[model samples]
Target chain A: MDDILLMLPGPTTVHPRVLNAMSQAVVNHRSKRYGEILTETNELMSKMFQTENQSYLITGSGTAVMEAGISNVLNAGEKVLNVVGGKFGERFKKIADAHGIKTQELAVEWGTAVTPEQIKEALDADESIKAVSVVHNETSTGVAAPIKEIGKVMKNYDALYIVDTVSSLCGDEVDVDKYNIDVCVTGSQKCIAAPPGMAAITYSDDAWAACENVDSHTFYLDMKAYRKSGNKDPAETPYTPSVSLTYAMNEALKMIDEEGLDKRVARHHKAANATVAAAKALGLELFADEKVSSATVTALKIPEGLTDSDFRGTIRDEFGVELAGGQDHLKGNVFRIGHMGNISYKELFQTFAAMGIYLERNGIVEDGAAGVSSLVKSYL
Target chain B: MDDILLMLPGPTTVHPRVLNAMSQAVVNHRSKRYGEILTETNELMSKMFQTENQSYLITGSGTAVMEAGISNVLNAGEKVLNVVGGKFGERFKKIADAHGIKTQELAVEWGTAVTPEQIKEALDADESIKAVSVVHNETSTGVAAPIKEIGKVMKNYDALYIVDTVSSLCGDEVDVDKYNIDVCVTGSQKCIAAPPGMAAITYSDDAWAACENVDSHTFYLDMKAYRKSGNKDPAETPYTPSVSLTYAMNEALKMIDEEGLDKRVARHHKAANATVAAAKALGLELFADEKVSSATVTALKIPEGLTDSDFRGTIRDEFGVELAGGQDHLKGNVFRIGHMGNISYKELFQTFAAMGIYLERNGIVEDGAAGVSSLVKSYL
Candidate 1:
């Protein structure tokens, strides 16, 4: 089968070097070289996260780290305010519930961003709330909440601030310290341009202290153990990690380093802009508010005549381009185009061309050429 | 740096094709092709485990699945009998402790196998025990417990039988149904010859029934959620998995398939026999009882004059062969040579040559060539 272009939220398109690195010979987890790889990957992740705080790699999907971030700090029966705008926001509440953490759901309409004022009001109403969880980028709706302002509001309160930057971390700017984020979690498969396997997490002293007070933890995902072992002379995970994935992540981080964070962010922004412009030019309505649309994935409403499966399947089956369909409630109503990671302007233009052809083939659009030209124009 | 031959119990040498497979383009977790990969991998793993029951793939290290196997069956406050013969055995107790399960430790001396009679006596003594956890291969001591007989003993009782085959599953024969194992867990990097990231677990109907009665599970490692989602038409993990590792595992399993299980097991046994024979020829004593020494890793006592680090480090630094030093109490007292997965007879011969040189350099053995010749003779 021909290689299909991945334009999903994650696992993103892995760089060739990163993919090749995954195929390297397995190394001892305790070896000096392996430790160096772990340390270097952690260091690079810290830089990518834009924080001096220590970052640890965990051998699981971003959701595992998300659970770890919340479970480690939010004790059972303790109140936490969860700001929900989309599917990921609801997931935060579910994870907290699974851990026995009491949560007050601050739900906004889907495809809309939550405000700092709303969070401040929730905190003000519940002085006993121990933490606040928010998603920086809700992949389900392509909406990125205003974390910087929410962090400011959280500062005035005693609640530990936690953010899930799984889909937004590298594509967009997220200054951990500036945002006063106590726990920042991201996955390797997103903007890091690595295959899915590990999630990188950074924690502040407060988050660690909160963990210290907890009586029990899931041993496999224990944050304190990871922090201790990961900070050793030569860094190492407390348990056997996904060694191949770590190698891939190292190569991915190297690519990110070479591209430079600012340029990478700008590149993602440009691609996202072009995609949105092309979608609009094709007479499609953007699902997310223009101001808050994520720089990683763009959600567009399904055309009246086209079913989500027909549209996506045609693009995938005919063009060999894999675009993400909306998740859960948004399924069949919206489609998403991911522009993060190793995707470029050329790929975006090609994806748009595929989208246009699908639309024209389905009799939804009169001229496919018009959409392709508009996409090329937007890319310029 | 050249690839160091991994002679550790795990993170073993990955085959070239397996590594190359990892570098393939990322696929959507929800896609049909991804589902086929998942289903195929699961099918292969079920074959490798010799179980007709369902097997699930987890994204974390083997330790994660170990925890999952135990926690899923044993409820909090439930009593479990753990047979401890070495480091990994002791870990079973610790994992149970972490999950609030009361464990009765049936400890045997290190470097010795636990007999079925001992397990039977323990089970007879404890009628309240809900489950029994045992390590099939004690990697730290290179001892393989008598699981087939122990499984028979477990059948007399109501306790669910669980086996940790992290280091022995494919290298050694383990028939889950024949052994009546309720939960069997193993890692990808061991005998499977894939890079670490995932653990494969098989559960019987009895184990599933036990899980149905338990409330409140660690969400990320929740077995039921994984089973449901993983068994769907288009198989998918509840969370994003280590897709790269899965691809590597698929390729590794394909290699195993081509070789045939009997041949693979025979190869491992031959290599282990040669390693042990060569060590004896060099005047080094085997750590485990010869009757129960594992076919995957062979532990050998450190000679009085040579420290473990110096001996293993010299072999690693000078010969680029990474051997594992003894873990925990056996540290600086024993070193292990792994002969599992993709390791060939030639590589084993080379490893013995390196060990012979290290012994001669340390003045522990005279005429290093004598040991290498013995290894080659034994291979013949």
Candidate 2:
């Protein structure tokens, strides 16, 4: 069998160089050598986030950030508005609610995107909301929510505007400072092309103030403590940072900067376009509206007689391609094709070709030509 | 300057093989290939831990396990008794206290051990204490506490016995399954001779049950959740496991098991004795009582007119021997020589010779003869 391609939203196919970085034995997190690595890495991460405010390098998955965001900022009965559109969006509410924070949720349809208008409506309706949180790119629905639009609306409100850029940060243009995004958090595995472990977070003074005012219940992710420790020296993390991932991300971020964030995002856009085009040529419906569809992932409605898991399993087991099945409520109906991180058009073509072959072998399609042709035509 | 030897408690000098293992580029975490690695790793880690309890790998440092240990088992107001002697002991208390667990601390002097009698007194004094915690080898003062004695004493009581074996496990023998120890935890960077990001922990059914009953505040390090997630399938984790550290640990554990656990501990003991022998031959004073001194890190009092940091730093800067200076209340007063993890006899002698060179350079010794001679005689 051929090597499998990961087309999932996260824990995405890592660049070989990134994995090579993880393989090195762990280093002393406190050594001057590690300190230099941490110091320089923080500087580079600041450049990537386009923020002057200090940041933290956390050692957990993207969802860990949602927990940290709430545990750091919100106290019990403190009001926070969570935008609910996809699975990740609901995660914001779940985490906040679990923390006993009073939460107001702006709900959207499963396949639809949450708009700035929706965010405005939610905020205007709730004067008690201390923070407005939303996903920049909802991986589950394959929709890039209007972060800039929401940011514009949120600028008028006193509430801090926090965004989950986990699937979007390096996959697209997220000028964190320009957006006035108080808290912008992302994971390592997606657009950075590193493996899962670390979550990179940049926060504004207002966000820090909120986190600080709320006394710590959060351990392992006490952002304020991390800020205090890293402040002494950016090389010093409050807890044991994942040194290997820090090393891998150091390299991955460099690769991103060398390629230029613009070109990287453009590549992601091209791959998503090719994926959508190939799906269209195969006569499959897109789960998300094109206007709001994510440039990093494409959620497709499972074709007739095909279940989401079955389609993904065949892609993995037979064609050596891996696609993400829709999660939670949308399960069994849609499968997603991820195009972010170190991925390229060339890889997308291979993924689509694999998909086509799997469909043909499973008697789900008459021939493999249509899907592969469309992906090639997308490049042409 | 020569390539410095790291004689600090941890992160000890990493093995080149382990470093090379970590340099392998990222692999998709959810891939069958990586899953195979986890499956093998899970089995190997279980063996290293001397447990049938499945391995639940976290991406953070050893303190991560302390936080996870408490958060998994302690609810708000649940009581804990900590046998505090050194840094790691205090660390365990801080972690528990941070979680709002009611704690009774049995504070031993800085350079002394925590006896089972004192632990029982603390336990007898506080019936509300659900867990009695101790650091097996206090990294701070080179004191090896009596976990076995404490475990034996605690057998008469109902509270779970949780031991922090971070600096001692693998390098020192820990009969985790033998001592009615409910929770036994260690770090990879210590005696395990692996990288720093992972923590290895074992739990008895009693401790697992306690974790289940507690209303834990954490999402990331909740041991019950980790156990449940791993129990879903033999090869699963609740969150993104550190694949790179997992790989390095897999290799490190194989090395330890091959060397034989008893022999590995014996090797460490011999090396430690050699370091102490060399220190004594040079007319240096050992900080801890000889009886309870750790077989990993040996703390020594700085000679008159020679401050600890200056002495250790000179060794690191000139001779490439990285000995550790004291922390907290003991700062600048003592230095430690670590015989933990991937270090050796030649390495030990080299460090001793450096110390002698420094002493001679400082006019304390006539020449480097004492350092070289003492270490050589010990080896002979």
Candidate 3:
């Protein structure tokens, strides 16, 4: 019943403009105007992906794109190299394993990042591996993998680098072109600041070529099916696309362009620095390695006297802050604070202040000092 | 832009209440409300299918369902029986073939109905067929295949029957249980009048059993994956759902309950008859066989003096009434008018009147008086 502030990795805080875009009267999907919108959107999406390669806009979640990314082109007998570190990395391996695809995993420690050398070693070790999959940003532990490094390693090994940039694309800089990613996919609700309904995927020509050579014969998630039907007439997908959601994405993209990519990235960095600084001042240990910690979500360790679940539960129930708790092995050990989408100094400061209130009220932390010293310093 | 009526089959018209529902702040996909909604929507969807078996809601167009339906269930070497009668029927066959399913096709004349005898004959001859595929309503040629009759024949056969009911589900009537359907699929934008972001699919226990026995590996669209994840957490799916679209469907389902299903179906029948009668009076012949004519889209023969493109062009440009032209091999031969979704008699009559004006202006008809008279009398 009360207003809730979402500081979880995504469906993050949707901007007012993006929500307002959905308020327009719904339009017919087959119309020329709608086609023009789809066409223009494809153009804009290409710019965002930093590639001239054709990008697909799927009206499903980021996971849907991940499914399509693998199943559409890969045959049942082929093998994929999964880079496993945290939740998303495990997710890629699990999804591939579910598809009966043979997986060669290069496992990284939970809080540590996966190195390019690991990917190269795996590729060198397994000549059967066709695609090397990794998450650019793992929301689970605030780790951002070195995509450029992995991409280079993949290039020398003749393997495709399929990156899950769901929590990182537009959060920090993703030089998709420079990185030479075969498939870089993202969801709308992350740094885009739009309500989630769509997932945008940019595929390199090699990836399209892979889709062409793919013998899996998938139907709904078939990129070839979409390509065959969509390219034929009037800028439409093989299936009916979500028109209202497309409108929201278009408006969100405009705002991104207006602010400029460099400025937006800089804004996120500023927020990350402020929040991390506040955490340090309060003697709260950072969960991820500082060098690779995500600008979008910061995983923080629970203080000596507090449990993660109880700490997060009180904040959510009382102060109405929705922070995401750690998953898998990290459960009850860490909590993530999302600074993605439309966030500001005032919002983060409020969160810090609220944490101070709850920790003090519950006798978890020593009295009011957290607010006076830790919370205010983030603004300064 | 001026308010325009949607006369296309699938993405027809969205109800205002549904649009309002989608515009509300999105709820967390993992929330209690979200779980209750996912479960309740599937339950209501089961009622539409007339089956007790659980169904999955997907965020994509009708094609996505068609593709996921085939690719995610049947293996590469499996066999399927396809009954091709209209555009959608042919599409089902193509999707099946793309998945490398060995297909036994019973080709019926376009705009004509298929006989149960044909299906029985096909099944009697080909015992290797694993499943039977057909479309309940073929939007392209305005033909509604006799699904109930087909179900009777399929019940006696060894193969499961999968029906593409994208345009017919909430418009006319579908007793998915009573009809003994295995897979019954529909889109969000059809009779439900939700936006074009979601696809609804119901699987009979037989279908579920088939899916379980089959070697399905497509992760995201695998119904079993949805079943395991959605069933595991009462309110959760394996992946993120289109939160706003689900909210929109909830509102639309309430409207369906308010206007009883039978009453709503009767409305469609009345509109169909009115449209056909009006077309006849204007010296235009119905493209579909009378017995099989659909209650949704009505395809009409382009008058001898007019081409399909010219007539459609005149209607959209001169009268602000857009109509669908024939595609593929049927181009320039017929134009279709859809009367599905949340259309009223006023809108239907206006479309008919506008078509008359366009015909008169194009010299296809001597006057608009006969068309207007027929439309009015048919309504009475």
> Judged by TM-score, which candidate is best?
1
lDDT of each: 0.88, 0.80, 0.79
Question: What lDDT score goes with residue B297 in model 1?
Answer: 94
How much of the real interface does each model capture, measured as fnat? 0.83, 0.51, 0.59
- What are the per-residue Cα lDDT tens digits for candidate 2 across B185-238? 778888988867788677888888887788767777767667775655446666
Per-model TM-score on C-alpha atoms: 0.98, 0.95, 0.95
- Estimate the overall C-alpha local distance difference test score of candidate 3: 0.79
Q: How displaced is residue B29 in candidate 2, in Å? A: 2.6
Model 1 earns a TM-score of: 0.98
Which stretches of candidate 2 lie above 4 Å from their native place? Answer: A20-26, A307-310
DockQ, in order, for the candidates? 0.76, 0.49, 0.57
- What TM-score does the predicted chain A of each candidate obtain versus native chain A? 0.98, 0.96, 0.94
lDDT of 3 by residue, B1-380 (tens): 33666677757667767777777776667666678888888777777666778878887778878766765556667888888887778888887776667777789899898888888888888788888888888888899988999888888876888889899987887898888888888888888878888888878777777888766655667788777866755657767788878878778877887887788888888888888888888888998999889998899888787776677776777767767888667788888888887876887777878887877777778977677788778777
* Cand. 3: chain B TM-score: 0.96
lDDT of 1 by residue, B85-152 (tens): 88888888988898888999998999899898988888787789899999999999999998999988
The CAPRI category of model 2 is: acceptable
On lDDT, the leading prediction is: 1
- What C-alpha RMSD does candidate 2 show over the true interface residues after superposing them? 3.3
